[model samples]
Target: MTEGRDDRGVAQTGSNARKVFIKTYGCQMNVYDSQRMGDALGSDGYQPTETMEDADLILLNTCHIREKAAEKIYSELGRIRLLKAERANEGRELRVGVAGCVAQAEGHEIIARAPAVDLVIGPQTYHRLPQALAKVARGERVVDIDHAVEDKFDHLPASQAGQIRGRGVAAFLTVQEGCDKFCTFCVVPYTRGAEVSRPLAQILEEARRLVAAGVREITLLGQNVNAWESSDAQGRAIGLGGLVRQLAEIPNLLRLRYTTSHPRDMDDALIAAHRDLPALMPYLHLPVQSGSDRILKAMNRRHTAADYLRLLDRIRAARPDIALSGDFIVGFPGETDADFEDTLTLIREVGYASAFSFKYSPRPGTPGATMEGHVDEGVKDERLQHLQALLRDQQAAFARAQVGRRMPVLIEKHGRHPGQMIGRSPFLIPVVLPASAGAIGAVAEVRIESVRPNSLMAEGAEAMPEAMRLRA
Candidate 1:
C-alpha cells in the first residue's frame, strides 16, 4: 500500500522514491511536455532513471505525426509487456503508462489491446499524473484523455530548472499548445486540440525559473508558435513578438529561438522581432507545405506561392542576415509533374539554408486520408529522394559559407574526440571545437576551419587569428 495523498493531491511515497523512465519521441514541444511530466511526478516521490531495467514505472511519451505511429507504439509495448512479466517473476511490479498524442488518439484501443498498460493520459491531462498513478495503484486501469477544464499549466509544479538544464545547456520551453490551422496532413488539431497560448505571466515565470536554474538559452515552442498571443502584465493583448521582447528582458538568457511557424500568421511585429531583438537567434523554421497554387489550395493552405515569396521578402527586409528553414511535403494528393517542378523552382528561388522534406502521409480523419489521387509509393519515394538531394546541396553550401568566418557558438556538449566539444552556430549548425565540459553554456568566439555536410569544424578564435584564415 502507498502513503495517502496530501492536500495538493500529490501521491505520497510508501517508503522509498520510485524511478520513472520516459522515452520521448516527436517535436520539441513533446520534449518540453516530457520534462513537465517528470516535474509533475517529482512531487509524487518519483525520480527519473535513464535505464529501463532499473525503473519502477515506464512511460512512453509518443508522437502521432508520421505514418504507422500507432503500430510503432504497439511494437514497443509488446517488448515492455514481456519486461513486465519478467519483473513480476522477480516479485517486482512494473507499471506501464502511455502519454502524449498517440495516447490521446488511441486511448481505449491501447488499453484494450495491451492490458499490461496501467494508464493512458493525454498530452493535456498529464498534469494530473500523480492522481492517475494513485488510481492505478488501486488496481483501476485509467485512461484519461479528456481535455482538462482547469488550466494544466497552472497545476504543474515549478520545474527543477537547474536539474533539467544539467542535462543540456539549452532547453525547450513551450509557451503555446495545439493548432487552429487544421492542415490536411496534420493530426495536431485532432490530437493536441485547439490552439491556446499560455498567459504572459506563466511564460515569463517559467523562463525566469529556467534562467535561475543555469539555462543560458531557450527555444520557445508551439505547433504554430508565431500564432501565440497573450496579454501583458497590464492586460493589453499582444502577439508572440511582444512575448519574445519580454523574454529577452531576462538578464541571463543568452540566446532565444522559436520554431514551426506558419506563413499566414507571420505578423508584422513578429517579423520585426527578428531584426530588433539581439538575443533572438537569426533562424526561422517556416513551413510552406507546397509551392503549386493548385496544390496549396487543395491542401487548404490559403497562401499562394506569390504570397509566400512576398512574406519572405518582407522578413528579409526586416532582418537581412536571417537564415531560413522550411517544411515541405512532396507527394501530396493530386500533385502533378508540374506541381513538383514548381516546388523545385521555389527551392532554387528561396535558396534555403536547410529544410525538412518528407513524402506525404495521409493522417487518419484528416481530409487528405479520404482524398482521391494518392500518389503511388514509387513516385513518392522518387520525389522524396530528389527533394532531399536538393536540400542537402543547399545545406552543404550554407555550411561551406561559414568556413573562415569568426562565429559565436553556444557550446552544448562534449564531442566524439577527447579534446573536442560541440555547440551550435546561430544558423543552428552543430560545430565541433577544441574545448572541455567547462565550455558548455558559454557562447565563445570560434573560427570555422572546415565544413562537413552535417557539422562544422572550428578552432578557438584566439588560436586562429583573422589574418591567418581563408576568406570565403
Candidate 2:
C-alpha cells in the first residue's frame, strides 16, 4: 500500500515548537483522518514534519484490512522504540502514538507489546488529540479507544487556508463513515462501527470551505460511499445522487468523484446521476469479492454473481463510456476449482479496465478464520498469480485503448525531469508530458502519445475536432 503524506514538503519547525510526523496507512479514509488529526494537533501549535528524526512526536494511522497488519505495526514500533532510547541518550525527548483501526482493535495490546508507545487513540477519538497530547506531556501513558458519542467533525478545528493551499488542487471530503453490511470476511464493521451519514448542510459547508481554499476537485470518501443518505431543507430524503448534484453546483469545483461503492446500494437515482452529471467523472470502483454464488453467500455479500453483472449492465447502460474497476479475492474459504473458474468467467464477461485482486487472509476474530475447507497457502498463492496475470492483461488493454485519445488532465505536480509535468486523467490514470511549471493546478488538454504499465505518455493537445467531440 502507498503511504499518504502532506503535499507540502518538510514544514519549517521554527514557528511551531512541536513537530509531528504522521505515517498513514490503509484506505483514502485513513488519509482523510490523518489530515484531520494534523489539523486537530495544529490547535496545540504542532506542525507537520516529513522526517521522523525531526519530530517531537510520531503517530501511525494504521489499517487492519490486510493480513498480519498488527504484526507489521509491532515491527515498526520496535524500530521506533530504539529511536526513542537513542533520543533519550542524546538528552532529547520523543513520544510515539498509534491511531486508526489497528489502534481501535488492538488497543492496550499495542502499549503492552511496545512500552515505548506513549498514547493510543482510535479513529473515533482523533478529535481529542490535543487533550491526549496534554496528558502525555505530564509523564502519562494514555490509551483512549472508546467510541466517541459526538461527531468528530464537530470538534475538529477547520483547517487553515494556507494548509489547504499547500495540499494542491485535489482533496478528499468524507461524507459517510462505517459499514452496516456485516460481510463475514471483513473487519470494517467492528473497527469503524455501524453506518453513519453526515448531515447534508454539514457536508455543503465543508465543500464550500474546500473550494474557497483553491481546491478544484473533490472526491467524497466512505466505506460504502454510494450508501450515503441524508435529508434536504424541505425534509425530502436524498441519497448520494442528490448529494453529488448539490456539490456540482459549488463554483470553481471542476471535477467530482466518489469511491468504494457497494452493489447492494447502486440505486436508480445514483445511476441517473452518472448519466446526467458531467462534473461527476465516468469511473466507478464496485467490488464483488467472488463470482460464485455459493462463495458469495459464504462471505455474506448478499448479492450474487448474476446480480453484480446485472448491476453493471444498468450502470453501463446509463453511461456507455464509463470505465469500470473492481475488487476480487482468491482462495476464499470453501472455494473449489469450479468456483475459481466461475470468477474467471465473470471477469471475461465484464472485462475490467483495472482491478485489485488479493489472496484472502482471515482476521483472528472474523468468522472466515474458523470456517472449514481452508485453502492451502500454496494453492492460494498459485490462484492469486493466475488471477493477477489476467487482470494485468486487461489493464494493459485498457491503457492501449486510451492511446491517441485527447482528454482533459488535471496538472497536479512537477515531473521527475525538468520541463515536464504530471497529472491525472478522468479515469485516475497518471499522465506525464513536457510542460512549464505554470501549468500546475490548471486543467490542460493532452493527446495520449503512448502507454506505460501504470501511466500514459502524453503531449500538448492539437487541433482535433473529432477527438474533442468523442471525449467524455
Candidate 3:
C-alpha cells in the first residue's frame, strides 16, 4: 500500500547498521515471510531502510500465483538491476536477492537472467539467509531451494522491526503452511509444499510475543487455515477452533480471525467456537472459487455448490451476525455462460459482505492450463467485469446497511489530515475518524456516519456511549 521506495520515510542510517529494504508483493503469507526475512538480516546487524537507494541488501519477496504476476516480478527485477548498477557506480554494496515462492519456482532462471541477484532462498530455506548472505559477501552467488525438513520458525530471531514497526494493530501469524488439496489451477502446493501445521506451543509462543509487541488482533494465516490441528494444554488434539478459543484467553488480545479456509475442513466444533468466541470477530473469508458443480469438479475442489451453501447455512445458524466473504474465479476453462449464471445465482443467494473475483489465469504444469476450452481473454475480461460489478454492488449495499450501527474498529494507522486516524471495521472496511495518535492499536466503538463504495466514514469513539461499546 505504501507508494514508491521511500513511502515509510525511514532514516537511511541507524547506529552504523547496514540497511535491508524488502519489497513484498502477494498474500498475507508473503507479508509474514518478508517480516521474518527482515528479522533474519536484523540478527546479522542489518536495519530496515524504506528507500532502495540506501539499502545494502534488497530482497523481492514474490508470489507465483499467476503468470502475469510472475512477469511483473521479472519487470521489477529489471528496475532493481538498473538500481544495482547505479549503486555499483557509487561504490556502494547493494546485494539484490529473491525470496519466497518465486525463488522456489525460478531461482536458477533469476540467477542466469538477472546476474545482479546474489542470493536466492526459498521460503523453507529462508532461515539460512544470514549464512547465504555470508557466502554472497565472499563473492559467490547463492541459490538454495531445497525442501528442508527443519522448522524455519525456530531458527528466526526476534524481529527488530517487530519491536519498531509492529505492522500496526493487527498482525498475521502463519500457523499452517502449504496445501494438501491439489487444485487444478493452484501452484501453492508446489511452491509452498505439502500441508504442515506448526505445533500448538510454537503458535502460542509467537502469539504471546506479538501481543507483547503491541499487536491487539492476530489473524492466523495458512493456504488452508481450517485444516490446522495440534495438541491443547491437556495433550488433547484440537482444531483451529480450539486454537482460537485458547488465543481468546490471552489478556489484551482483543480480536482473532483466520483466512482462506476450506468448506470441507469446517468442523462442527470450529463453527460452535464462532458462536462462543466473541473475540473471534464476526467475519469469515471462506473461498468458494466457483458455483458450477462441473467447474468445481474440474478444479479438483472436491465440493459441490449445494455443499458449500449447506456449510454456510450451518455456520450462519451458529453465529447469526457473522458476515461472510468469498473468493471467485470467474473464467475458468470450460466455464460456459450457464456456469457464469450459476455463479451469479449463488452470489445473490449468499449476500456476501465482500468478495474477490478474478479472471482465472492458468499456471504452468497445472491441469487447468492444458485443459481444453480455455476461456478467451476477452470473454474472461467481460465476465470478470460483470462479476466484479455485482460484487461491488453487494459490498456497497452491505456498507450502507451498517450506516446506523455501532461497530468496534481496530485503529491501524494515522490518516492524512491532522487529528485523523484510520481503523478497520470487523468486516475489514477502512473507517476514517477524527482522533489522536493514542487511538492506534485500540479497538474503539465508532458510529457509522456515511457509506462509501468500498470503505465507511465514521464518527469518533466519543460519539458512542460506554454501555453500547463492544466489550467481548
Candidate 4:
C-alpha cells in the first residue's frame, strides 16, 4: 500500500501532515466518485493512503445496492474503532467519515450507530467535504446529505486532473450522473438523485486530456448512459450520439463504448453512432432485467418485451457484427413459472455473448421490496442456476466462433504465467498471448488459435509484420 501525508487547512509540520484513506464499497460510479474525492482533498494538501491503520482521516465510500451493504459498512467501522483507540492512546487524533450511497441512505444514523464516526457525507454532498473535515477537526460531528440541482463537476476539477502515475490503453469517462427511470427494484434514483449531464465542452476537454495521457479507448459511463442529454456552453443541445461523434474526431483514440443503457433511451441518433463511428466497439450491454411484460410493468421498467426486441433489431441492423450483453432478474415480485420461461425465451432469442443474472433481492425503500408475492428461495435459486448455465453455453459458443479469425487486441498487462500477456479485443473479449514485457499498452494483431470457456488463446500473425513488432 502507498502512504503519504499532507495538510488541508491544518498547520503542516514536516513529519505530522495528515493522511486520508478512502475504502470504496461498490459499482464503477462509486469507484469514480472515490477517485474524485481523492483529487478534491489532494488540492487541499490531503494525500491518499491505502490502509486505514496509518491514516489521520479514514473514509468509507459506501454502496447501498446489495441487501447488506449498510451492515457491512457498519461492521468495518466497528473494526476501525480499535485502531482509532490505539492511535488515541499514542496521543494522535484519527477521524472517521462515511460517504456514498449508504451515507445517503442512512444519514445521521451511521453517526448514531458508530459514535466514533466524526463525519457523514452523502454522494451528492461530497463537494462539501473540505468544510465537513474542518468542522471534524474542531471536535464537531458533521452530517451533510443535501442534493444539489446544479452540476457538481463544476466545483471539482476534471476527472483526470492530477499527476499521471501510470498509463492504460483504456479509461472510463463519466458523461452523466443520476437516473430518473426509477425501476422499482433499483435504489439509484433515491441514492444518486435525478438525472444530470455535464456540458459538451467539459466532456470533450476530459476526453482530450485522457487521450493526451495515452488512453486509446474510452467508455462513457452513467446509470442510464443512453439517456444522456446536455448542451454545450453556447446552449446547443447534445446527446450521447453527438458526444460520440465529437469524441471520434480526437486523433489516436482507437475505440469508444458506453454501458447500462435503458431500452426506452435507444434512439435513432445513438444507433447512427454505432453505424457511423468505426472506432466504436461492436458490443452493447443493454440490461432488460426481466422478459415478462407483467414483471417489467411491476418493476416500473416502462418498456415491454416487444419494445426491447424491436430495439435489439435496430442495434443489430446498425452493426451486424456486434455482440450483445445483458442483465436479468430471475424472481422479481409476483413472477411466475411463465414469467421465468419468458426470460429464458428472450435469452435464447438474443443469444448474448455474456450476461449477468441475479435472483431478486429486495432493497430497502424501493417499491418492489414492499410489494407482495415474493418468490420462494428454492425456486429463485433453481431458476438462477438454469439461467446461468444457458448463458455460459451461449458465451462458450461465441468464443468458439472466434477461432480461425483475426482480432485487434490492446495489450493491457503481463499475465501471471511467465512470458504471457493479456489484452482485450474491441468487443471486450479477453485474449492471452505470449509477448515481451514491452508489449503492454500496444495494439497487436493476433490469430485466434483456441477458445476457452471465457477467453481466447492467440498468437501474433506472421502475415501482418506489424503484429509481431513489440513496442519498446
Give Cα-based local distance difference scores for all models: 0.86, 0.87, 0.84, 0.83
| Of 2 and 3, the candidate ranking higher by lDDT | 2
Q: Write the per-residue lDDT of candidate 4 for residues 215-330, one digit (tens) a residue.
A: 88888889898888988567888789988998999998888999879889889999999998988889999999988999999999999999999999998999999999999998
* Candidate 4: regions farther than 4 A off: 1-15, 159-167, 436-438, 460-472
Q: Candidate 3 overall Cα lDDT vs. reference?
A: 0.84
Superposition-based RMSD of candidate 3 using all C-alpha atoms, in angstroms: 6.0
Point out where model 3 deviates above 4 Å.
Answer: 1-15, 160-165, 436-438, 460-472
lDDT of 3 at 417: 55
Worst 10 residues of 4 by lDDT: 463-472
lDDT of 4 at 309: 94
Candidate 2 pairs with clashing backbones: none
Candidate 3 residue lDDT tens string, 1-472: 1111221223334344577899998899999888888777766667778998788789999889856876787888899889989988987778999999988888798899888889888988888888888788788999988865676656666665345354767898989988999999999988888888888888888888888878899999999999999888899999998999889999999999899899889999899999999899989999999989999999999999999999999999999888899999988999999999999999999999988878898898788899999899999999999989999888888989999888888888887554667888888888876684246888788788886555777865334445433320
Q: All candidates: CA RMSD in angstroms?
A: 4.2, 5.9, 6.0, 4.3
Looking at model 3, which ten-residue stretch has the lowest summed lDDT? 1-10
Task: Estimate, for each residue in 352-406, the C-alpha lDDT of model 2 and write its tens digit.
Answer: 8889999999987889989999999999999999998998898899999999899
Q: List TM-score per model, in order.
A: 0.93, 0.93, 0.92, 0.92
Error of 1 at 432 (Å): 1.1
Give the residue spans of candidate 2 off by over 4 A: 1-16, 436-438, 460-472
Please write out the lDDT profile of model 1 over residues 205-284, one tens digit for every residue.
88888888778889999999899998887889999999999999999898999987999999999988988998899899
| Candidate 4 Cα deviation (angstroms), residue 102 | 1.0
Number of clashes recorded per candidate: 0, 0, 0, 0
